[model samples]
Target: MGTGNNRTITKTRRKIRDVDQIKADLLCARHLEQFKDSKRPEDLPGLGQNYCIECAKWFDTETTLKAHKRGKPHKRRVKQLREEPEPDPRRIPGAQTTSQSIGQCYDTQSAHVAHMEVDT
Candidate 1:
C-alpha cells in the first residue's frame, strides 16, 4: 500500500510538471509572436505617448507600457471592447449627454475603474 501511494504521488507530480511545461511553452510562443509583431509601429493613433486607447491609460515609460499590455485588467478590457464597443451616452435612451455623465458611464465599468484607480 505504501509503495502504491508513493507511485500515485509521483505520477501526479509528473503530470503537474508536464502541464506546467506545456503552459510555459505556450506562453513562450505567445511572447515570441507578440515580439515579432511589435517591431512595426502600431497603426493606432497616439503612438509615442504611451497611451493605451483601449483602457484610456497613459504609462510613464515603454517598459511600463509593455508590462501593462500583459496585465489582466488591460487584457480583460481589450477583450471586452473587442466583443462590444463602448456605448455612446448620448445615443443611449434616458442617458445624460453631459461630460460628467459620460465619464460616470466609463467609471461604472469594472475594468475602467480598476485602471483608473491604479493610475491615481
Candidate 2:
C-alpha cells in the first residue's frame, strides 16, 4: 500500500468556491461568446448598450442605468431575490374590486365582487 504522506500529497484538490466562480464565469462568458456568434449587429434591438440589472429593461442612457444598477437599494433587492422564491400567483389575482363571494361573512354591508361606476 502507498504511504499516507505520499497519498495525501498526490491527491488532487479543487477550489471550494469553484462552482460559484464557474457559474459567474459562464454568465460573463455568454456576453462574449453569444455576441460574436451572432454577426448581424443591426438585428439586435436597442443594440447600442445594455439595460440596468435593477430595471431589467431598456434605459434611455447607459450612464443613468449604470447609476441605478449600482444603487444600494437595487443591490439589496437583487440579494433578496437570490434568497427568496417568487410568491404564489393565487395569493394576489389582480386589481381587487368590491365583491362578496358565497361563504364570505359581511359585517356592515354587502356588495358585489367588482363594481364599475361612472361619476355624474
Candidate 3:
C-alpha cells in the first residue's frame, strides 16, 4: 500500500567485542591462578583425602577428587572465583585473621551441601 521509499531503513548492526571486557577477563584468569596457588600445599597431605580451598570442598579419595575436578559445579566455581576480588584481611573479625577462607564466602546452600557429604 506504501511506496518502496516509505519503507523503514534497517541498518545491519556490527558485532564489536569490548576491549575492556577482554582485559577484565584476562585479569580475572590471572587472579584465579594466583588464588589457586596461594592455598596449594607444596607436598600432598598424608591423608588420602584432598581439599579444594576455593570451593571449600573435600574429596575423600583421589578418584573422587579426579571426578570432582571434571564436575560442572567445580568448573563454575573456578570461573566465579576468577572474577571475584580477594577479600581484605582487615575486614575479617578475628584475633589473627591474616587471610579469609573461601568457606566464609560460600552461600548457605553450598555450605549445607558440603556439610551433607559424609567423609568415607
Candidate 4:
C-alpha cells in the first residue's frame, strides 16, 4: 500500500563487475600478497599505490590510507583476510605435504562428467 517508486529503485540496483574480479584476486595467495605490498602502477585510482585490497578501494594519500586502516570496515576486512592457522601436518590421517594449498583444481573429473581436454 505504498508508492511503487521505492520498490522499483531497490530492484534496479546493479552489481559492479570489479567485485567479481576482486574476489578472484583475493582467492589467489600470490595475487593478494603481491597486491598488498607491491609498488607497481595499476589502472586503479592513484595507480593502486594507496589501496585496500580487502575493500577493493584506493585512497589519495597515505594519511587517508592510515585513517581507513583504523576504521571499522578495514578492521573487519583485516580480520576476515587473516589466514587460518594450518592444521599440524602430523595430525592428519593421510596428508601428503605441509606446504599450504594454492587453490588448484581438486582433481580431473571422469570422462562421463567431463569434456574432452584437447589442445586448441
Candidate 5:
C-alpha cells in the first residue's frame, strides 16, 4: 500500500488528525439526528453522506452502509460509544463537576470553586 492513500483509510483510523472531529460532530444536533434515519447526498460522498456515526466511517453507497451496520465492527463501535460517559454540556470552565445529572440546573462552577477553596 502507498504511504499516503486516504481513500482506503477510515476517519477514526487516520493517523494525521485525532478523533476531535468526531467529538465536535457529536455536539451538533444534525449529527445525532442522522442516526435515527439517514439522508444521503445526491452527488455521492458529499460531506460524508453515508457516514457511520459511532465508527466515524464513510461509505460510497447506502447498500454498503446498511451492510456495515449489520457487521461486527459497527456493532462494536456502537457498544464502545455507549460505554463512554456522556460529557456535560453545562460543564464549567477550569472546574471539575461535582454534581452530575441532578434533574435540575445545578451550578458546577460554584461547587468546583468551593471544593478548590477547601483544598487550598
Candidate 6:
C-alpha cells in the first residue's frame, strides 16, 4: 500500500512538471515566433529594447520598462497569466475496480424474515 501510494505521488509530480514545461515552452515559442516575424532594423514594433523577459515584449525606455518588469504587480500578473488550467484528474486513465454483486436471494431465512419485517 505504501509503495503504491509513493508511486502515485511520483507519477503525479512528473505529470505536473511535464505540463508546466509544455506551458513554458509554448509561451517561449510564441514570443520567439512573433519576434522572428516582426523584427525590423530602424523601428521595432514594441519599442526597440530586447525582448522584455517579463512582459515578453520589446520596450523603448529602459528605466521605466525595467521598473515595470521589476514591479511586484507585473510579476504577479505574469505569474497568473502563465498558469495553465489544471488537467482534470478524473479524466486521467487509471485502473477500475470491479463492483461486487449482491444476489437478489437472501443469504438465509432469518435474514429474509428480518428484512421483510423492517420493510413492513
Give the higher-TM-score candidate: 4 or 6.
Answer: 4
Off-target runs (Cα >4 Å) in candidate 1 are: 1-48, 85-120
Runs in model 5 lying further than 4 Å from the true structure: 1-13, 16-24, 30-47, 85-95, 98-120
Question: lDDT tens digits, residues 47-92, model 3?
Answer: 4247654455545677777788889977886776566556566654
Q: What shift in Å separates residue 48 of candidate 3 from its native position after superposition? A: 6.6
Better of 1 and 2 by lDDT: 1
Q: Give candidate 6's error at residue 53 in angstroms.
A: 2.2
Tell me the TM-score of each prediction against the true structure.
Answer: 0.31, 0.29, 0.31, 0.39, 0.42, 0.37
lDDT of 4: 0.59
For residues 2-110, could you state the per-residue lDDT of candidate 4 as single tens digits? Answer: 6658766766553322443455466666555554565456655566678676677778788898899889988876565564546565665654443324463223253
Worst 10 residues of 3 by lDDT: 111-120
lDDT of 3 at 28: 51
User: What are the runs in model 4 whose C-alpha is more than 4 Å off?
Assistant: 1-43, 83-120
Clashes of 6: 0
Q: Tens digits of per-residue lDDT for model 2 on 1-120?
A: 855675555554321223333233334555334433544545433563554432333445677677878888668756754553455576555545443333333332445333443221
Among the numbered candidates, top lDDT falls to 4
* C-alpha lDDT of residue 52 in model 3: 58
The stretch of ten residues in a row with the least summed lDDT in candidate 4 is 111-120
lDDT of 6 at 97: 36
Model 4 deviation from the true structure expressed as Cα RMSD, one decimal place = 11.2
Candidate 2 pairs with clashing backbones: 98-112, 98-113, 99-112, 99-113
User: Which digits, one per residue and each the tens of the lDDT, describe model 1 over residues 1-120?
Assistant: 344567778877544223223333333555334433554445433443575545644466778888989999878866755453456555756543332221222222255422222111
Candidate lDDT scores, in order, read 0.49, 0.46, 0.49, 0.59, 0.56, 0.50
Clashing pairs in 1: none
lDDT: worst 10-residue window of model 2: 14-23
